[model samples]
Target: MVRGIRGAITVINNEEQEIIKATERLIKEIIILNQVAPENVAHIIITVTEDLNATFPAKALRSFEGWTYVPVMCSREIPVPKSLPKCIRVMLTVNTSSAQADIKHVYLEDAIHLRPDLQLTDRHL
Candidate 1:
């Protein structure tokens, strides 16, 4: 079955390095938590807050050898009032045996505030 795993993270600045680091961290957590292999990933969609245009989050994954064959795309998030800033979010679709409720969705840094109900542990990269 195809399952979707979601994750988000907040960056400290709009610099290319910061954006890349934060996006890498977020994707790593998502992959680890979901136990997803690159071969199993169908596609990944990433979005960043309008304030962050320094680089595309997908660009960071290029350095990961496993991601070379994975399909990935990036776009700007909808500008919602009072939304978290410097946030990068991703929805990764993968072929998995896990149930929807069993999937782990990661939210890190200030982006954790965006999904209080997930009650994820406080972890920083």
Candidate 2:
């Protein structure tokens, strides 16, 4: 059985290093929390806010995960008025036997503010 997990974060800058670091951390947490195997991951789609076009977050993730052949895509978020800026969002489709509720959805750093009902302190990864 495969499932998808959603995670988001807000970057302080458009620097590649910052995006890479934040994405890696969030992705790692998602994988660890869900106990997902690398082979189970079908594909990943990452979107960065319009203000961040300096680099593709997927590229950094591919490098960090050492997944040279994985299907990854990057796109720009819709420039909606009054939307969260400097945000990097990820939608991961993975093959797993875990329930939806068991899948950990991460909202890191300032992005935590998006889901105030979630217990950020419950993050174990």
Q: Please, what is the whole-model Cα lDDT of each candidate in the order they appear?
A: 0.89, 0.82
Task: Summarize candidate 2's per-residue lDDT along 59-87 as a digit string, tens digits.
Answer: 66666555666688998888999888999
Error of 1 at 123 (Å): 4.9
Top candidate on lDDT is 1
Q: State model 1's lDDT.
A: 0.89
Candidate 1: the clashing residue pairs are none
After TM-score superposition, the amount by which residue 33's alpha carbon in candidate 1 deviates from its true location, in angstroms, is 1.1
lDDT per residue as tens, model 1, 13-91? 8999999998889888788777889999999999999999988889989888778999999989999999899899999
Best by TM-score: 1
Candidate 2 TM-score to native? 0.89
Residue pair clashes in candidate 2 = 1-96, 2-96
Candidate 2 lDDT score relative to the true structure: 0.82
